[model samples]
Target: MSGGPAVVTRFAPSPTGRLHLGHALSAVRAHDLARGGGGRFLLRIEDIDGTRSRPEHVETILRDLGWLGLAWDELSFQSERLDLYTAAQGQLADLLYPCFCTRAEIAASLSAPHGPAPVYPGTCRHLSPADRRARMGQPHSWRIDMARAVERAGPLTWHDAYAGEVIADPLAQGDVILARKDAPASYHLAVTVDDAAQGVSDVVRGVDLFDATHVHRLLQALLGLPTPRYHHHPLIVGADGQRLAKRHGAPALAAMREGGADGHALSDALRRNMLPAGFRLGEA
Candidate 1:
């Protein structure tokens, strides 16, 4: 929050699987943005989803990044900092309500037959905390208090390096998930808290999450966080023009390693795509 022209950016990754093309692009862009400004690039392990997160995955990520030749100035682990995430959860406790509405319930509540976005019917937003806790003891997910959040902060803006200006309405994204039905903390809550605490000035990621800016902006405003610049690069899609997903299968980094595939080639490809060789933020 107390910085000048130096851009402090971070590249966060989840340790659920081997790094893919999308991850490579995000890491490279983040590295370029921070180094481009003669600033700092940080690495954050987003292992909020305890179920799928594995220690081996974390180790492999470090290996993958080293192979890519992408450098970082700082490193953080979301799992290691549970207290922060817990504090944010407490801040959002009453502010956030328990969502007992299952997917079936939400779908049934969709009254706008032809609306572009399926609006929430506010099925569980009005539950008392005690009642919510009781239901949560059984099973539930938690959402932010959009009504209170909007009242606290008006509409916020996000400036993207790739896209133009962007504005978001928190009310539309009613009650986003800060915690899952099973886990206590969520990716959104952990990422926002980490970014705010680290004074991250720039966010570089794949354009596929362009809409997520709205959610992140809302979190920043609600939590009184410093708004950071966002830069979502073009996603690397398959020949079908679809995002790289596990279904279609990406060449696992382990598989590549066994095949004698060099890791630097990944970053080299990324450099060729957007930034030139040896190009930093200032030069970019």
Candidate 2:
């Protein structure tokens, strides 16, 4: 069968600023895949970090996409759904732990020869209520009890459109944050829960998310949700053959919008990398 979307796909972008080229590529590609498969294209604003997200940035993002003639049927924001994120955290709380180590401490531990950066030293994890309460006034966040979550998740598997097959072990990834002590929740918790609630069946994102997908897959398993097919699409790189920065993306997409890129031109720009046969960007 020709390459086509098998289920509902999404492009969840953080509304921190204007959509960049990398963001546009991911969004457009996911949109195309969904459309091609006769599916729906959903947009979710990852506005969990309220400090960075602004109303102006959100407006600009929508305007930019509208300029390109891309439309979505559904939209959501992570900031609005704190209750759902908490429920997901609760599921992990029984098995989850709290992490209070700062960045410098983590850096010092990782600097030691303990394999590829000791995935979370597992410090400050699984603290007693007394221990947890002790830091109530101090700045503290919570982490999932990965050990128990993994056991709860059981064996899991998923197929990737580009990477073929993917399997993960949560223990290796270590315990990631579920809720920041100060913030309502962490991104891992928000995205996992949101995807489940939206009933997203396929995750079409950039290749850089390959590692994060493992963690996401673990969350899906832990939550007892059906795992979605993953497609780690190639990222659009710049002249240096690397993923373009947020600033760089702002200009690229802006220029595209300014050049009267109705529909065809935007499509052409996105398809540039995927069109040519035997054309690999950085592999050479």
Candidate 3:
């Protein structure tokens, strides 16, 4: 059981909307994993996207988690940890470069597809000093120099609870943004940095983020941070056979609580992996 000590885990939810069934499953799973082994569970509010994140949604998140009987040892918000992210960025500055391309410009520059979405063409990676100087006033974000970063990190692997040991392939994502023009840190950077800072030993999240792990593994290697065991659980899906999302109009945990639903009963069912009728775990 490797039960030497309790492994720390976290559930980071962005407060862009109300807590949904999907969020409930994630929080409960993480809390159980921590408490099951005499470890501590932590909560993190990933509200880096100021434009979309709302204070009301955050209040609802705490209320929903409490109703579900999921409690955390400590609570941290990304908004309060700006300096930590900035310090991490400074450490990786050598491996990052300024990206000046706008959304429209990036889209226009892409002809061949790299992945599901358009991969950045690295339009500004090789910019001349004069050209860079000319655009100093333009807002720019920082991107990881994937080539150098992977070279430095070498071949890497991370363990998964179900998938076993897997090799990392961060190149597929190309040069991902480390810092955003609107936010101090991108999700990839912030989550990686925060996990390391918070001493999270295990990462419990949805399989939809399985691919993103490749990039996170690279970041951990580059930043000299310890790699945590990951369990990419299946996502909760709606009756329409689609992953639960706001767009899908999935029922919110708050709505369920208000409608006379029992939080303790829901938590028990979730602990037993018995989702309500009509709802099931989505395929990887």
Task: Single out the weakest 10-residue window by summed lDDT for candidate 1.
Answer: 275-284
Residue-level lDDT tens digits of model 3 in 1-284? 36486689999999999888888888898999998878989999999998899999989999899999888999989999999899989999898888899988988788775555577888899998789889878999999989899999899999999799999999988899999999999999999999999999999999989989999999998788999999998998868888888756788999999998999799889888889989998785
lDDT top scorer = 3
Cα shift from native, residue 65, model 1 (Å)? 0.9
Query: Model 2, 55: alpha-carbon shift in Å?
Result: 1.0
Evaluate residue 279 in candidate 2 and report its C-alpha lDDT on the 0 to 100 scale. Answer: 22
Assess candidate 2 and give its TM-score to the true structure: 0.86
Q: Encode model 2's per-residue lDDT on 107-210: one tens digit a residue.
A: 78774655534577777764678997787677767877777777777876678887677777567777777788556887777877888898788888878777
Q: Tens digit of lDDT per residue, candidate 1, span 158-199? A: 898866688776677666778887666776777788998998
The candidate maximizing TM-score is 3
What is the lDDT, from 0 to 100, of the residue 233 in candidate 1? 74
Q: Which ten residues in a row have the lowest lDDT in candidate 2?
A: 275-284
